[model samples]
Target: MAEPTDTAKTEQVLTEGNEAGVPRRDEERLKKWFIGSIDQGTTSTRFLIFDGTGTPIASHQLEFKQIYLHSGWIDHDPVEIVQTVETCIEEATKEFTKQGHSTSDIKAIGLSTQRETTVLWDIETGDLLHNAIAWPDTRTHAIVHELKNRKGADKLQDICGLPLSTYPSSVKLIWMLRNVDKVKKAYDEGRLAFGTIDTWLLFNLNGKERKLHVTDVTNASRTMFVNLHKLEYDSTVLDFFQLDPQKLKLPKIVPCSDPNAFGSMASGPLKGVKITGCLGDQSAALVGQLGFSPGMAKNTYGTGCFLLYNVGEKPVISHHGLLATVGYHFGGQRKPVYALEGSIAVAGSAVQFLRNNFKFIEASPDINDLAATVKDNGGCVFVTAFSGLFAPYWIDDAKGTIFGITQFTERGHIARATMEATCFQTKAILDAMEKDSGHKLAQLAVDGGMSNSDLCMQTQADLIGIPVDRPVMRETTSLGAAIAAGFAVDIWKEFDELKEINKEDRTIFKPQMTTGQSNGMYKRWERAVEMSKGWVDDSDDIPPSS
Candidate 1:
């Protein structure tokens, strides 16, 4: 099934348009409209071009380095991250033109980024103050402990809809201002600018002239500064961190879908193209799946796994240990949609561990084939708590452990167990969502790298006792941003018009295992999880007595 050539497409368009006797301008308009999306993830950067139907026609992706200066400290070079984005845009644009499509066809662009990765820069010099602290970094653990015990700490979650944790960008910012001298000096001089990855990319993409410093509500909600109800920074939350807004130049908060909030790109292959849509990576995936009404849920299995369930127009403070955050804000008269999110810190990365660290396979996709060799886990269970578990458990002291291993345990069994680890966590999160929202989802929509495996999706369906829906085009994160951009510019005026986008060739996996058998396997996984904790004692990192 080769793609049609440029000559073939041109002929087909002209023949159809002339047969109908339609005006030339209308036909040209149909041929010249497209949307671009910049999907910046935790481990890679991508640029994708989409037509009005939401299919990614041309795209390029680049993986950047993850810097680990110390244990539990993961940082990314802010300069290198921005450069990779520029390169992706240029390369993707070249691909589009090679197919006889002009850059002018791309009417608008949208951006989605890894949320809560903190970056600081000089407002005047435009120089990065330090490396971007990634979301999973635990350097702020000590600070998080201190903040949790302070006065009014219990009220923080009610105000911000997030518990005090090291994942928030505000926590990372506080750690830098106290320890990093360069950041402290800039703050003292009133020249410091702070932002998440979205804000950083927007600043550079707009170039020095515009210097547009802003972030959308989806990204802002993760920073622990924005009030869930007000959609603006909360003074009480800022006071808890002892942050002075006068000293630090924070990015202005804007709606997720806006026509003119984020200015046009100042330079690039797509120079002067307006950026009209933005979302945090997970939120963008939900939009791409068209989870518009209440009760729809989507799970993204990327570097980490996230399950977000729509909680309708108002925020619901989770009593089941989930984070409450904004789903998307279309701006204008539309009310903001809120969601309950469950985050598992390790998903596809565990597969990478077996490939890169353990040498079990040469490529990522090989795990599916390898695991398929075995009928089941062979009484084995792997608790992939590499950096400890997340979501409902939130056990920081746990470590990766394998249980029920005998001489009979083959590599195939281990591989199957590894895949089951993620499925088990997803099931746990779904249960929590059901408790908080009081509605059991009929089916789960899934996307991202790991969802490509039929074995994994089937395992998910069996354990959760619900159908798992996967689309043929798995790049929904990019498509979600493209949808936002299209709506902002009137390329799409209503949600009903998007019903056909990415709707064909979808695969749905139904439960294959019986209820009793699935429940038995899940119970064993829970037992393993409980045993895996308390392995990393508080004093394990301390030097032994001389």
Candidate 2:
């Protein structure tokens, strides 16, 4: 036989399929695979569709209303958040199908949500008890102080891997149970369901019928109820918050990637598509960036900024102020990965502040052009402690304060300083992470809205004294979710299968300034931070609107 050529082999297979009464289109369809990711964020909701190669083929994003009921208070209508997710899925699916692909090609869906944004609902009625308390909301400021004074407060981080702070869902839930009449009533009656955004969305997305009240380890770690070691709810920690493990309807903790832990959609554009994976947004970013090895780190700049450094399979309790959190846990005998995290309360929101409040620029990206006009910050420093400084500083009384503003300072100066604020904080976090982990990072993987700006990334590289790597597709958060889902469904079987995903056209910003220059800028930032403290008194909370 003249050995069949490669083209002849393909033709023979197709001919055999046709002769076997199988449609050629169905055979061709087997070669195509897709995954969907729901990236529910603080300021917006997004649904992205990705091919097997981790390329985003279609996506849609929608910014929802940010309810500022009072100073330092932020709320989101739980109904609106879910609606936005459905709309994004519908729109993104339309786009996906428009590109000559079948919806059946979507093997599974994954969820990545803003962590610690607490949502409570009536377990029986499935009605929200109150507006969702966003993670950054400081309405629980008083509660945090009380929590810090409570017995076992000092041992909280050891148990749950989080400090006694306003950011965790536990504090917010405690505040509601004490203050909100309906919330307290529901709690007393055992009708209350407590969940971070993941649990809430999963509850709704899987349809109220299934009532899929579950959370991945990454999200559960932020609730301060999970024992970081066991990866399960800790009754001792629950008691520390005055929560009854029996009464409170806490979500079951599951792995980040699982075939059946998260149920299939009941109805929607992706009806019956299994939700095979879920992770907190920052964790998803790390997974998407392929930061699987210890000492590898990734930073996500959304409404806020979070830097997660993988510390291997075991959790490391930070002696520094950074948080200890689960990096990610893929199911099926895979051990949970741990991370040391440093959170900044304001990042892209500062640009929104300049655009809306200061009118310094018409849009976010415009600030980059404006900042470029100024060679440097012109001695201006903006301590964007809008609610309060988070992570290493944990300053509760600091308000947004601009220091070193002078007659020579312009909006461009302020813009440059605003950009530096995030970069400076990142440098602080990176330094602290190195100290805690005992390994110096040579580079940082950066993503999210703010990382799109070349100027900002270059500044980050200059300030941090390391290369900043930004992927060509900046939607690593969404991509991470898809990767998790893909893994669960066998679209990808192992970590090595992802080596080629999101690997092309990455821009690496290298250091452009002297070490002395970087140190000087950081020193100025530290001074500004110190000077901005104590701007808000303990009793400075604004009363909620009637």
Candidate 3:
């Protein structure tokens, strides 16, 4: 027999791996396989391309408009979000191809989206019925209050693992159903399609040509509709909300890492690529940080701060005001892992307030430099409750407060206080996680926009009295989706193999302040937070439907 040619050898290697159902880890094979991730965040939409080793090769990010129609309300155009995703994919893939990589090498795509942002659209035409209700929007406060007063409302936490709050998609969906005539009409006619950001993106990306509407377990967990134990929409909860599933077209809930649920991209640069994975942003951050094992925890500091502590298989319902949520579920025989989460609604957004609202800094990063100029907060403590405090505190009536401000205070002092506010909230959440999970975090894996600030991270370490690990990538949200996608396609055969990737150089911020000093500062922060409560008088405010 004649020796096989080079082309024949390559074909045999690729075909044999598929036929044998084994992962190909050869360097040559790895060089030809790439994974893509769409990180649809609150402030921006990003498309990232990564090689098998979890290194980002190319990325494109676009900041979409944040619509504030009224005070304490936030919305986003669903159509614009879809367009941004397509634009990012096209631009990023072009850069990837420009860097001597084949667009065909992009094997699969994963999605990490901002969770709980409600989107309603026409089932047939796919036209958005209303602006996507942002997770931070407080328009649903009255509805949340009314729901809380109902009989069986307190039991909601037992079933959904979430308290009645405007932060959830269910409340937002309810608001749309009551306020938007188009949404109500569609629901009455059985033509309304409801989903979180991930489902909306998946539906639009898969196009109207193929009927695809599904949300991952992590995203579904945030809607206050799914039962934590059953991992499906609860009938009792839906009935309590007066929502009949038969009337509204809700997305099907799927696994976080699935080979086929998400469907393929019908258009854009990644037209033929299979979408194999999907996660909410926080869960994606956890996956990106490789927090797969029990007792591992990660904190993502984006527009908001989310700390997820992995609690193994069985869910531990939080008695400490933390949330019990599905961390990630890689389908097919793998059991789902649970997490105790503490969510802080304002983190990087506080910095944005400083830049845009206060004009204390010209840019977001400049707050760090300015903050470094101050030796201390000069007795100032900012509660940062611009959108109400979340997590252990759960004080929705609180407004942003700046305490101990005197003639001696300057922008630097306030900046320092601003940074400290997030650290204090993180420390509060960490304390709650430990209480709920019974696992004291030895160290925290950190990622996202605010984690880039060395001062902020060091402060976090000091406050928590533990090490803070920040990966060099800082884009772990995207990396996490890429990791999930890669896993589904057999590019990454096992979780053990992931340990070898993205482990080169990481920045570790160790505790520097004494325990007593840290405790004292936190105590002062608590006092400031207490003082900020009850500032909002909701009685005079009109209802969302009005």
Top lDDT model: 2
Relative to the unseen true structure, what is the C-alpha lDDT of residue 182 in candidate 1, on a scale of 0 to 100?
99
Which runs of model 2 end up more than 4 angstroms from their true locations?
1-31, 538-546
C-alpha lDDT of candidate 3 relative to the true structure: 0.88
lDDT digits (tens) for residues 244-343 of candidate 3? 8998998899898877889999987788788999999999999899998999999999999999999998888888889999999888788999998999
Error of 1 at 132 (Å): 0.8
Q: Give the per-residue lDDT digits (tens) of candidate 1, residues 343-384.
A: 888888889889988899999899999999999999999999
Better of 1 and 3 by TM-score: 3
Worst 10 residues of 1 by lDDT: 22-31
Q: What is the total number of backbone clashes in candidate 1?
A: 0
Tens-place lDDT digits, model 2, residues 59-149: 9999999999878999998899999999999999999999998998788999999999999999888999999999889888778877888
Q: Please report, as a residue range, the 10-residue window in candidate 3 with the lowest summed lDDT.
A: 6-15
The lDDT ranking, best first, is 2, 1, 3
- TM-score of the candidate numbered 2? 0.93
